[model samples]
Target: MTISQLIRPAHSFRLTPVVKVASFHIGRASAFRATKTIENGAVNEAVVLPPKDKVAGSYHWDFERLLSLSLIPLTIASVVNGAHPITDLFLGVILPFHCHLGFDAMITDYYPSRRSPVLNK
Candidate 1:
């Protein structure tokens, strides 16, 4: 065996089937929205999921816009209150969650875990 192959940990055998199962679930979820063709060779409109950016008047970009708009007020209130009990309580709950969402989105865009076929050692 090559030195590189010897050093690399074996890839998890479960990954391929897990991914296939997840794909099946997604297909099932969207099945109701599947398009249908009429006998006359015309296609009928199908139900579809809405884009996240409902606020921006753009039919796309929902998740980013939600985090941006929501965090602004939360940050302002937290700063103005300066750790007051009520603000502290609300901020404690929301700040970490918002930060998590933003970081998760960034990481997904930059280095998608799903895009890689093999897990890192």
Candidate 2:
């Protein structure tokens, strides 16, 4: 048998009708509301725009990962009393940064000031 016949069994596949794309697009100033049906049976929905600053632009994943990974080596050095001064220095610097990022993530997830309009500002 040929490779094409072996792979497909030839006439099994058929194409379906493609739906037309929506003419309207969501913009920055869009206000969200309940979906409403028009006389022609087309559905419409409102879009809500959130405050710009609610999404932070500056998120430092690299620095946060560095601080997290540093803890492992620093803890090991402290336990073994290896390279006392350098490890102490790194531990002092990294510990606070690690705590700050951890708490910041907790606050971002649980507290979520952005969801509350009054507190978000």
Candidate 3:
């Protein structure tokens, strides 16, 4: 790797899979969404698990531990203080984000590339 590449901050690997899994949630909600037909007469939805991210595996455990552990202090502060603005705000946001990461991991595991790549994407 070049100096510039090495020095640059690592791109976000965590949020990517979450985004891929979350893409289906974007746009308006519809009970029966129409599929697009391609030249070969096949659906061309582009969403898929962008090949495996090797970088993410290196720090996956660390990230999950940090996020979950962080909630301890925030939760304690919020409970002890009872409705303090900063604590309440962080707890509100971080809690949901933590939950999203967990569910994303679950989706990624159960829904492999060989199966429904759409949802696992």
Q: Give the C-alpha miss distance for residue 40 in model 1, angstroms.
A: 36
Give the higher-TM-score candidate: 1 or 3: 3
Over the stretch 1-104, how does candidate 1's per-residue lDDT look in tens digits?
88976675666334455434443445465767856532343368565658776466443256557756777787798788677887777678767877776776
> Could you give candidate 2's per-residue lDDT for residues 68-121 as a string of tens digits?
887997898899986688888888888987997898776666765635434423
Query: Which residue runs does candidate 3 get wrong by more than 4 Å?
Result: 1-56
* TM-score of each candidate structure, all chains considered together: 0.38, 0.45, 0.51
Quick one: ranking by TM-score, best first?
3, 2, 1
The most accurate candidate by lDDT is: 3
lDDT of each: 0.63, 0.71, 0.77
- What are the per-residue Cα lDDT tens digits for candidate 3 across 18-37? 43555355555674677653
Order of models, best lDDT first: 3, 2, 1
Candidate 2 lDDT at 78 equals 93
Best by TM-score: 3
Spell out the clash pairs found in candidate 3: none
Model 3 weakest lDDT span, ten residues long: 12-21
Where does candidate 2 have its weakest 10-residue lDDT segment? 34-43
